[model samples]
Target: MNKQDRLNIDTKCINNNSLNSSQEIQEFLEGYEGYQHLFLIGFESDIGAQNCESRTGQELGPNNFRALIEQLQFPSSNSFYDVDLSSLKLAIKDCGNIKPVISDIEATHQKLESFIKQIRELSKDSIIVVIGGTDDLNYPALCGQSAYSEKLNLIRIDPSLDFEDKYRKQFDDLEPQFLEHHQSHFKMTLGNEIILEKLGEVLFYGIQGFKIDQDHLDQIQTKLGGKFQYIYFDRDIRKTMFDIQNQEQNQCKASNILMENRILKESQQIELIVNIDLTSIKAQNAPGVSEPCPAFGFNTQEIEDIAFNIGKQENLRIFTISEYNPAIEKFQTGNVLCSIYQHLLLGIGERLKNQGQVIVANEYEDIGQQELEQDYFMQQAGEHLQLQNFDFDPSLQDFK
Candidate 1:
């Protein structure tokens, strides 16, 4: 890949013959109208990863993952008629990659911020799945989300917490950091006063204790109090798995760690971003990340359950998969990531289907129309029109 090459939407992706109806995500090929639950966006810059001197080839992540997705078969809606994926009318689109200005990484993030803001404005209900160049990309991703929601709940699944207190010093310092070294999302977000103030809650799962300073973690925990909730380390997760695997009888009940959390329940009512760092997985399952500590991560099944359950939430706005290095793993990691995608899509589709609402393209259109109508009605009603003019009881306002 050319380092200074400007990013552009690869129209070749939409025209590819590999994406046939029987195989691949058919909805992606059907124009923007068919997309519902998920919209995948790619980024071609691995600048962030390179800054950390961790690895390169993250720029190739989107293309490699897309190539894999194109060959995989879509779930048969007919076979699972009971859940009725057909009725749910799920759609997923490849919105193409965010191309940055020629040789400008900050400009690239600016473009991403604009793209995310546009997507949020266009369709707040649709869930966006960002295929990132690195975890640092999460900064711009959430910046766009901040445009719409004042406060957001972040659910981050990573083996390591990316918080550098020095990076949080000044907003102007970010561009230099982005250019120089790999910046952590935690540091970047906190670095910006706007994002920090807007962060209502945070949950860190599958964290690698060895990668972070315990004092820094405790300081953040104490600062946020209830908002900084639920830290599940790799060891705790392994313990759960150990217990489940050891149980010969009544094993099914013990294996219900996916959707059984209080923090997850609260996350459903607000704007939530589910970020999965592929490095959080064991090296055996995912060797494609920029930084991989072989035996120090979650297994495939554990990651899948976490993703699936998080995907099931109704208010999930964005799902990001980051730190994937295609050149490092040589396509082996895509298989596991693909399976996780399957679980996530199925969980999301089932949730919408069970709720008896297929919220996608047309639903957004209806919302737009309703808002327009409400605006017109409000204008005609007049804001200054008093309750006494309509003979309203004064006591009614005080009832609540």
Candidate 2:
């Protein structure tokens, strides 16, 4: 990495009018530059079949990846943004400084364990951006920091809920069909990578149309308590026809989304993730995948806007982006990739708040002066206490 490669978004952007983020957001990004807070992590399995399907070509290879890193443009970001380049390269360069660290999990189970451990150790409350070999990887990343299995707010904004116990649908379409229907309930299916511990743990937004089975519904309602929230948007079916209220309250305002039957009733906080699978975009923008769907605006810029807002919230602890198929859309892929990077970068700028260090300037003098002050106070307190015999009873309040 060169001097030009790093991006301290918070410190640099304080004066810029272009990227207006809140103070809370400014603090998040300021401290985020610490090694403990930034990770450009990639994950893939080495099973011959799975590896070929998931990891083989999906990586931010050295050259192109470096280019992206070298191009990040934050306010007064050490002068590199001034370097000359065409609009395209300049745009590609805007992705925040993403340090590439690919985790290619070989067939061995130990490798997975090692990868997870290293990531947790390295992440000191910093953001871990993993290039997913499959959507399933989110489970481990989230669990790595879970507090005794207690649920935190986790949100998955994909077109569909790609929640499967097994990868294969028993040589059947039930799973594939389910995948399609799930998309109808979502804007797209970028991160079908979900576990069914609780439908409440996940929230599906941008859903359009869905053909959910009764059994699935029962499972969610009975077993999972229908705790998750789903903002289903059948765009082609309804096509978000109203913008009359440009006063759009939120992304969910655009479509006729179905909220979870019971989760809303209970009303608890959720963990949120916003995933965008490539094929969700127009086949022309991002093509070829195990599953394909035709729907525009699934990448609907609004989703990104929603993502920025969601990404900004103080409660959102983890942020993950997956399934960017470059092999499918070469020409446009860079821009899409750039957008993903920019969102995370700027979002990092928005969430990784760093309270500038508090330098206690009068170190020696301050410490000596403080000790003298403490002695004077202690002596005065001793005299005051000598006048009375009293028992401290603060802790006994609870007993009473």
Candidate 3:
């Protein structure tokens, strides 16, 4: 198919309505009046995995995730966390899948980049969640966001670093058959100077040290300079989690590894993009990826925590979950992904609530003393009280 034809949204999964009357999320789909808080788009392509000679079937990731998520039921008010979810009124829109050109990888990237640019321009305030076919799609996602942002920061959660230096003699000597597919997986790395120029800081989280070549690591370090930081699977992640636990108990200062890495700092002003490769999780937890880490990786809960923390960042612009292959999946990976998405949404809700409070406080500060007459003050107080009583739709107030 031509590029324009490929840009059409696949709505098969979206039109499949839930049968349960009590379904909370299904009610928020696409017909809301105000701004949508979340926009879900799928990049449907396994050509990257095919080119890289890894297992294919990630092309089905988006629809598979949707089929499972549609079955979920929101917790009732009497449950453990007894908050009234119906009152939140969050809206989510599934824009459906972007069909990819199998024969031309570059064309696929171009189509995705253009489509993402449109989404960003159309709804600058919305959280854009991309369901990916493979990690290579991350390159286009980053490019699309950088078009509108002056400075960008990236956090890549993966088991092995995907950097491969083309200039190295070892790389130059490789056979053409091996070389073509090998380079398909390296687009997200710093091998491209254009991508490097747009990035202000980058963190390679959940990296397995043994899986990386020493030369590739050294090469990335040299190119990235002080802008690069990494958290190792064996050495650092566990300790970071321990530090976070201690901080929560008030036994130590409030510091997190992400905070130390500078990605989660609320004061930072850069637009952030997070790319999560499912293979970063242990094989037992996420066996449905192109490449599974059998020996060591993050557990499901740890990955959920990471997602929530990343979501809470005020500057998070785009979040991509990639490398999910349903062909080899053992039935649990889809559920794990759905849980991660829910946690991320919760984090976003918390951020919005905090910002709403600040906005209310600022309005109070802006009131002039002369205007605070007895009757006027009472009227103003009543309005503020009414604001508290109003149905809280986090998307109603523009945080931008």
- Cα lDDT listed for each candidate: 0.65, 0.39, 0.65
Best of the candidates, TM-score: 1
Error of 1 at 168 (Å): 15
In candidate 3, list every pair of residues with a backbone clash. Answer: none
Candidate 3 TM-score, true structure as reference: 0.73
For model 1, how does the per-residue alpha-carbon lDDT over 1-400 read when each residue is reduced to its tens digit?
A: 2211111111334423121121223323333354454667787678765545566888877777777765764332323424444446465556667654444566777867777776666567778888867777787888989889866888788766677532222355544442423445576676688887888878777787788788768777766777885455556666776676788533532115545655565555778888888888889889888788786877787777676666678778888888778888856788777767767776776776776655445555544465466558767776546643675443432100
Off by over 4 Å in 1: 1-37, 74-87, 101-103, 165-181, 241-255, 357-400
C-alpha RMSD (angstroms) for model 1: 14.9
TM-score of 2: 0.53
**Candidate 3 residue-wise lDDT, 10-95, digit = tens:** 23336432211112223333333342357677878887766656788988888888888756642112132222223333445566
What does candidate 2's lDDT look like per residue over 138-236, in tens digits? 554554444222444455555555532223233444543122111222212223234344223445555434523445434445544445555555543
How many residue pairs clash in all the candidates, one count each?
A: 4, 36, 0
Give the C-alpha lDDT of model 1.
0.65
Which prediction has more favorable TM-score, 2 or 3?
3
Query: Which window of 10 residues has the lowest lDDT sum in candidate 3?
Result: 16-25
